[model samples]
Target: MPVGHFPLQDKIVVITGGGSGICFSFAQLALTSGARGILICDLQLTPAAQDLINQTPDEVHFMKCDVTDWNDLEAIPPKVEEAFGKGQVGDVWIAGAGVFEPKWSSFIYDEEKEGGYKAMRINAEHPIKLTRIAMRSAISVNKPCAVLIVSSGAGITGQYAAALYCATKHAVVGFTKSMGQADIDENCKIVCILPGMVSTPLWTGRSDAVASQFSYTDEVCITPEDVAQGMKEMIEEEKYPGGSLMSIAKGKLRNVLESKLAFANDGSEIYKQFESKCYAPIREIWNGERGTKLS
Candidate 1:
């Protein structure tokens, strides 16, 4: 395994929602890092093509896609292979497509079924479904790959009125953690990212709408570029093993502390030593001897 290596050289990368925002930024960086081709899938593609076609020099291809639609996602692998001209499955996929509700994000809403379901599907189920398919293809071909899940800080923190959004994000974080462990069981890598308040189209709106409660000073919102750079760093570094949990916010990057870390006492010994003493044995029993007991 090429750990801590910039390995995108001459690889085909597929990114859902790569048309704009953080994923777009990531694509630009990936191209500069030597990725041979990038296929961008998004419901809104014309703007990106128009903008990126003449604006950027990268080899960018556009695909019109609704990430919420399983059929659209199922067709991606073959399309990518056809474009890149290799039996190689996607070298990397960024599950970056997402949605946000405006006034209907609340549980108190009356007629907002579409908003709720769409947001949930786009933000949570879509990525999970796409990642499962990608994992299957990679394992079937015995190819190594990486998947970056763009979860949000709301996955950890709650949104006041946006209950459904928060629920979707929380589900994403849990699924990401599970998938990351699965990557360990397999040979691939799953990197989960939790970005704090970011400047993106998700927050665009009319001035007439009853002002957003989530707004902060310009300094509070991290640039999409910064988040993209953080993701690039994570993908480049081999130290970020499978099941890596990271947060990008306030123009800074750091690892999201696992639950076990909180239980460790402040002392001279390393945290891993405390982890070994406290949870290792029970984990073994639970995962091995105890879990094997059936009936």
Candidate 2:
């Protein structure tokens, strides 16, 4: 309830998917805030990241990584502390690893006799794995921690014809919220950002393409910097509580009350009744033994 603020000064920060886009912006801003060290973990370095690499302070380092691989991801923390110092692994981690839906494939693709769920692997599972790794390492070192999960508007509103991408992002949103609530008195705070149509290579799949797509004009599309800044404020300002979700679009951000239950009037029996009706099928299928039967 009090005016809250946390500083990143001299903290060792770890960011997965920091090679470009909003993650790069976070890396840049973090250095300006006096971060002691930073590790950029990406599939590989990109040309766009060269300048950032050049500008990194004495201790910040970049490395090639595959977030989907547990061995690759788990190897990051030790390397970070070894470079920075032991038990000084620092607590700020941004799980920004993700990928867009396939240009030609559906949620489930059978290519060459092998079915794959690529989006689910990169966009959802990677974040969950990396977050777990970061939290476990931080807790073992007795450090305070925070994690930011990068999701998309699809996390809130499922996309048509892009079910896999939408499903993965939605999973991230749910996971972040659930973890925050599960560890309310814990040391780390988990947050999620649902960005809409940001200006980045992720949208066009080509470097030359405009940031806008899907009827969203270039002017209306938010820049990656916009998302980065909004997210920074949301965390540093402490305006939003742990487990809070916010929607970012066109350079503005506001709380996302995605569920009616979040704002239902105190003593609103109608909402209770409506919720019961809405959840009856789910309850019937998911409650204990009832969930085991197929029929």
Candidate 3:
């Protein structure tokens, strides 16, 4: 039987990167659970996300946005107010948009290029900025809010080939834990979802990417819907306190103890395979034996 009561009932939700993957899945579930309003911000809406807007023209809105751009992020507050009405803060805010260190914005390729690593900016810095924006918006209206930070298993366990990706995820895990202190006065609860091997475009799209080096076959990966359900439970379930790091893996959800997170995949063969994949190219780049390719 379907649960009758939805915690998100009548809530206003805002999700960044609600285009094609986990964020889009959560947006669908959020609407089904009775969210009164939802704003999806992404560079462009995928056909699926666009179709959702078509089906629920009244409750959902899409705004083209680049999460890494501060001006674009600064526009969200006004957009939220415009969509839902003045003085209304989103009840649930999800920093759900991220990348997996693609070549164009890679740490290995662009770590020292003009600005810092784009992956860090998108995966780590964007969430930090958005969280601050969200908290301030909630505080201004004296409203209680829930913020979900989309982290990863990589955040806890180290990945040798994707050191920068690992570092970006780690940054947010620590940031979310520290933000729990902010809830003491403002009632702005924050939590993180550290999903394992999700079958999303961010990880699965590039066949030659570092993420593909891992054993993320269908049997080993969970669907975006699976992670989305975990996200819903985290928001509605009382047991999940502020700063909780919930791990969603193979359709099972567990609360992660930060101290014990390192053991998540300690003896896994997939981890070993992942560690071995790009040692040569990475070493070549570091030792200046090969030219850096930034395209």
Best candidate, TM-score:
3
Task: List, residue by residue over 165-244, the lDDT tens digit for candidate 3.
Answer: 89999999988887664454357778899988888887766766466566568888889999899899888776666677
Where does candidate 3 have its weakest 10-residue lDDT segment?
286-295
TM-score of each: 0.79, 0.79, 0.82
Q: Tell me model 2's lDDT, rounded to 2 decimals.
A: 0.70
TM-score of 2: 0.79
Query: Which model, 1 or 3, shows the larger lDDT?
Result: 3
Q: What lDDT does each candidate get?
A: 0.72, 0.70, 0.80
Which run of 10 residues does model 2 get worst, by summed lDDT? Answer: 286-295
Q: List runs of model 2 lying over 4 Å from the truth.
A: 1-4, 108-115, 204-213, 256-295
lDDT score of residue 55 within candidate 1: 65
**Stretch of 10 with least lDDT, candidate 1:** 286-295
Cα lDDT, model 1, residue 10: 80
Name the best candidate (by lDDT): 3
Put the candidates in TM-score order, highest first: 3, 1, 2
Error of 1 at 57 (Å): 8.8
* Native-to-model Cα distance after best TM-score fit, residue 88 in candidate 1, in Å: 3.3
Q: In model 1, which runs have C-alpha deviations exceeding 4 angstroms?
A: 1-6, 46-49, 54-58, 104-106, 113-116, 205-211, 259-295
